[model samples]
Target: MYEFVTGPLAWIAFGIFIIGMTVKVISVIRLASKKDKVVFNHWSWGWSFRSVYRWLIPFGSRSMREKPVLTIVFFVFHVCLLAVPIFLLGHNILWDERWGITWWSFSETSADYLTLLLMAAAIVLILRRIVLPEVRIVTTAYDYLLLAIAVAPFVTGYFAYHQWFDYKTVLIIHILCGEIMLIAIPFTKLSHMILFFFTRAHIGSEMGERRGAKTW
Candidate 1:
């Protein structure tokens, strides 16, 4: 039964996932590569690098350092959420068997705990947005909806593993939610993941041009 569910569904999910991602990436790359009136130099790339560096090393910027609590929470939530799924024993085993790739698993306890933490953090973030009117005003409907959609798979998967409901039903819900998010990524604000670098580069070049700083 498990094999049956995984076999055809996995292939369908994977096909949609790959084709959607490819289309989105190609579209963003083409858009970003279009010629701009402003000329860009190496300094524009340098500024984009600097922006990434600042994100990594928050200590370097007062704005970042001042938001230590939010920064720590966000990073912890994002890192664990990303790492656990890819490195969990069940996920790795399934990936290896289905996709012919092998990976080492993180400890089971660690994976489970991190999944819970990520879900908790996601809930907290949603609540914060609601309770904080400033954030609520700035957040679009897509932002809130995407946040819920992104978190649903983790929550549902955790419950499914624990048999909180029927195994097949819960698992199907989790997988379906994940597939939806994957399909939506290209068409939504989530597209920022692919476009942010080019956007930054464009901004950097425009800034340099406006300042008459050597055409970058």
Candidate 2:
């Protein structure tokens, strides 16, 4: 079971993630080209890049500044979300062993703190969805499920690292949850992970080039 999860199952998860995201990106671009050809008419790379950059930075946009707390938490959660997993010592070691690939890694202590921070942020996001009337109106069970999917790996990983339960079982659950997240990203609203750039670029170009207005 351990061997299969780490070997073939890992490959399958990565394969689906890559292929699914590629397909989605290509399809969206092609669809846009056909349906919204006007978008490209006045597309400005400058505005697009500026928009993406501004949105990437915390409190860079007016809307973000308006909600300072959420902006900080959102940025911290996402930064740690991407950072902790890829730079985790254990994950890097696994990649080194499996594919002869490795990168700079965080100390175990640093990873622990980042993981805890991520979990806390996830909780805050979940609560925000429930507590904020406007946000709650748009929230759905699927949204909560997606949040759970995003955070489950970290939760299980923390337990696995601490060996708080049966180490092997916790480790297995962690790997599985991580893989599930990878597989889900390109298919779900989590796709905002990739699509945010493209959509932001379109909006930025339209608003900036076409209307002489700032998007951010």
Q: Candidate 1, which segments miss by more than 4 Å at Cα?
A: 1-5, 35-43, 57-61, 201-216
TM-score per candidate, in order? 0.82, 0.98
Clashes of 2: 0
Give the per-residue lDDT digits (tens) of candidate 1, residues 164-194. Answer: 9788888878777766766666677766655
Give a tens-digit lDDT track for model 2, residues 68-186: 99998999899999999999999999999999999899999999999999999999999899899999999999999999999999999999999998999999999999999999999
Q: Please give the TM-score that candidate 2 achieves against the real structure.
A: 0.98
Q: What lDDT score belongs to each candidate, Candidate 1 first?
A: 0.70, 0.94
Model 2, residue 58: distance off in Å is 1.1
